[model samples]
Target: MEHNLLQAFTTRKHTVLTSSKIDPTGATSTGSLKVKDNISTQGSQEKLGKSGEEEKNLKSNKKLEMRAKDTGSFNIKMNPLNKDSLDKPDENGREEKSTESSKKMQTKKSETGEGHDNSSFEAHQETQGAKGHHGNQTTTAKIQQTTAFISKQDNKRQANQTQIGRSGSNVMLDVRRRDCSKTKCQYVIWQCHHQCMGWGDRLRGIISVYAFAILTGREYRISHTFPCNLKEFFHGNKTLWDEKVITAEHATKRNIKLFGFLPTFGSWVLQSSNLSETFPEDIITFRTNNDIIPYLRFNKNFTKTIEKAFSMPIDDFHYVTLFRRLFHELFSPNKQFEEKFQKYYQLLKPSNDSTLVCAQIRLQFIKVSGMKNVFKFLQETIKRVGKSKLLVSTDAENVRSAAKTLFPEQLVDIEGPLGHVDKPGSGCRDMEKALTDFLMLSKCDILIHSPSGFGQQAAMLKYPYKDVYQINYAGVITNLTIPIFKLENLYEELGPLGGEQPPSLPSRYIKNPQKYFT
Candidate 1:
């Protein structure tokens, strides 16, 4: 569509340019003609409240830039609708096309005249349909600059322009003169490229990236296609989600790294090597829950090492405490999720000891590992911790049914695997149950879980007095006390009130340590 911005130019006003919009949260936003309630598409100066939903439909709008120069001549730069104006005839055609575009710009400038005559521009202003000018337009132009898109898409469908990956980069064209030449500004983007498979796994992936950003002092941006439907919850402009929605196209171009499984030591080694001074890459992405524990340790040595490496003051950074803070920043409970959690979390009364236990039996993976002992483990938990309400969260359908059968009245779940709305799991698992399960599990006084990041996360999020148990493949139930189960002590349980020790990786997957490396 065409805009009368140039026509409005002579009116002596800065028009509202919607060609680009910067997200307030520092995330990149698409320049689309989206209906934002009653907000006008025209460049109206009226500001609107942030309470309504808007449709994001991009427009091929033209941007007109008029810059007042010190020489008393105005430099005008207009972005044309034809993006292919800069396309090369071949891969080798790039230089030629660039030269041609430059020549055309020079030709336009020459046509405008080599002399810095403001009266000549004024004489031609009305000829170009710029009316209502009082006198000679007081402006000067020493240099002219224009940026055009060279699209690779077919010409019929209205191909989009190449996006500059800066946060809130939606402006179509930039205007400047020779003296106004600026430095190339670079923006840092950290994305979690893990497939939106499971909710807990997705959380682990993003939380890892967030930790990375925090360590490097960068803004972490969120996307739309993430596992959970968190739009309404974060729409209130709280936390780091206060900006605009990110499109799939823009996110694809900004993905810099993809992290898979890397054991704790391997991760540490990579960090020391790749990030000794600073992150060399422009963007960093990772797989779901890669080996990050080593980088996020709570020990004095680890703290000093990280601080020395990043040259930042983080002498007091604790692994669990930092995790807690990041979790709070990323995932505030939505009203819907919170309502469901509170309903079942407070269902059963606590015992005289006020001890409530929720066991997250990862039946699918453990059974896949050839451990066919879900029922036996539940029975053992009941036997050892009597009268404690059993809130089970498992993936297998059969496991949920069996728990209901075994504990009948005593067993309660957050409506079980199928009851969740998000449905974060795959194969024999229920995905939606992840949020409900995690929320309810966090409320329990004790957690008996399989040795996975999901349980590890919940356990770390639990309060100080709360306890956690890691049920290994061998059915050895080990309680995780204050400092948590280190990589060396995963097979062994710590004593009730031991001395203060620093944090380390749990022994569950870090056996060979390098075995889990990608």
Candidate 2:
């Protein structure tokens, strides 16, 4: 029986081992004439075993493999978590693996639930090995501590990032962000922080400086009193002031200084018979540079002159309104006006030639009470001077003739139409027109003027000569403290004119002169 069994097995093996022309393993035959008729159809255990061995060999040498792998194919998926895979050499063929890389593999293996029972002994061995390599327990501990510290720091950083992202939520809802309730800083901080730099800050400072400059109303670098005719006030020399910049401070200071001097003018006007108790101080004190008209192209009256003396901006309609209300306070009645006019004459008699001639003509309106004395003074003046050119300004022909008799050869009369205006207080109109022409035309070394606005205005003009003289009216001499006769006496003693005996005058008239009006 054993012989028979051995023979059968050998026959079966032989039959199964038949080789095909195309495939030596006899796996490719398909038709009835193939090995199927020669042996049992089912593949034998020996052939199956041989196929599995071939597949294993194929798995080891991928080049020879034709069939897809079964057991090894599944291992490909698990290879990433395999410790053997991690133990494999790196791209550079280095045998070493970092702890981080090893831990990563272990962690991956843990996720797969495949051999995660890591022993405390293994961990202790790793610690002992690390300590042995470092040769100091503290050093190994410090490395571990540093690693843990870094890990904690990383976690904290992540948490902080989360908090920071949410921090603005409250900020956005803050009431401070509302435009209606915004603080001054909040309104501009964004622009200031991002848009404004050094240049922008400098520009802001410059704008502020300019705004402040405008408020002060001062010349960029110079100063002067208020009611200042910036147009007439020279930048450096008190002329040509229009182009200059000014500030309110400049205007205020100037106004105060100017108004302080107004009382002097006001007091003079107060000393007249027809004058009321009304004082000019009330107006002059309030006047500012803006109210003053610096340049008068046409003739101006007393009211106009006073109006132009202030620096305040004034509209014509407003001026008329103010004038109507303050007329009595500003002007004197004719009788008192004439009296004050006489006082100005005595107070502001010229100290020199042109003024002397002007003053003599001015005395024509005075009473003859001082006439004999004046006549004697004139006779002596002629004898001492011998010969002099006489320019007489007068509306009266009789007065002109009398002056001619006194200086017959030297007399030159300016003849013009006088008092043509029928209106009250308009007598000065014709006189002003005539004087304007005379000033432009006459080349006389000396000049005389009638007791009128035109005469005073003409006298105030800047003339080129050795002497400037004028007869001032009382209403204009506000600061005078001394007697006019005493000043006249002293001036006569000084012999400023061509008089024989010493003329009399006061020190105040010489050193400090009041504004002159004829």
Candidate 3:
């Protein structure tokens, strides 16, 4: 019996989980079942022994007649197949002893349900409870026990251990990382819808953008960086330039003077300064027009600048040159000019300087040697009403020659020393020179003028005119009221008297028969 029991202990087909392999403190191992801590396993066995005794007594006390008693404890019985048990027969004398033993075996197998020793299960539970109560094991030992328990139920397992000591405690990290939202940065261009008089309108938009850039220190690359649609800038048809369109920065940077276009330059750049402070009136453009003059009047800056530029009596030629230089500075869009105006315009105020300019238009009479010009009539009209206002028109050369001839005593024949006299529609530099020459004279409240475009410019000055006059050969003096006039009638009447009448030379004049009849 001892040998059989020893053999059963060794070859019971059980699994062993030794503490030496699991927990360093050592644990109990009977079959595959591992029970940690020897004390708990011993206690569990003691409890099981008590339960067995109690179960035996309960079975003995049961009444044996008709019904089977249901005792929770599993029933045990001896094997009936053994020769020792077969030797006994029941009182019925028919092998009842063997039959009873077989019945007990069947009952034990059925009652136990699981074909395992219950004592081992009770021992394992007690061991786990003790380990949980103590809580003194390393994480590795705990993990091993837990894994073993889970492996008993599930076959599949995986491990992913990581050392997380490097990264700071304050930083939170995800095991799996991803990118942020996807969006693109872009820009758009806006445009306008109508027909403006000329490039004046187009340039106005350019100037506006340019001014904004300069004021805010923003950069505007006219061609490559800021390729604008012309239609956006103007009200007419859309245009795609085959070549690069000219830009204000080009002329400003190159320091080039654009003639016939000064009015545009004046309107765009100088106009703003007129409202702010007295800046140099220097301007150059490739074109000029009445539209430019209206712009000056309408713009607060140009009006202010012009008012300040000519506010004081400009007497000396040096002063005039200084004024011209100052004027030019106002018109230049270079960074230097921008900074200067931003500083000066802010300081200038209407109350600080209230000086007004006095304008006069002097139109010379006609000469038979010179041909008729309609520009003179326009000049005479402006002279009539704009004597007090700043006049920008000029006289015809014939009318100017006539003035030199007739008013030789009052006005000197200052011949051809004028620069920029070749500008188209300049009216022979009469307006530019007149503004400089008589800017300080303070004489001639009214312009005593004949018909000429030059006179029209002088009439353009800001003024109230009952003070201007338009003189004709008939000595019929018209008031200085109208801003424009017609000289065609005057020229017809002043022409040679009639047909067949020899042209008589006026006093102090010689017929240029050699230049013509010769």
Root-mean-square deviation of every model: 29.3, 60.4, 59.5
lDDT tens digits, residues 325-348, model 2? 221121122343234333433332
Which ten-residue region of model 3 has the weakest summed lDDT? 121-130
Tell me how candidate 3 scores on lDDT: 0.23
Total clashing pairs for each candidate:
23, 49, 61
lDDT of 1 by residue, 394-511 (tens): 6555455545655665777665344323233322234346655765565565567765456666665554423455554333444343323222221111112223222232322122
What ranking emerges by lDDT with the best candidate at the front?
A: 1, 3, 2
Which candidate wins on lDDT? 1
TM-score of the candidate numbered 3?
0.21
Total clashing pairs in model 1: 23
Q: After superposition, how far is residue 174 of candidate 1 from its true place, in Å?
A: 36
Error of 1 at 396 (Å): 1.0
Question: How close is every model to the real structure, measured as TM-score?
Answer: 0.47, 0.23, 0.21
Q: Rank candidates by TM-score, best first.
A: 1, 2, 3
Estimate every model's Cα lDDT from 0 to 1. Answer: 0.36, 0.23, 0.23
Question: Scored by Cα lDDT, where does model 1 land?
Answer: 0.36
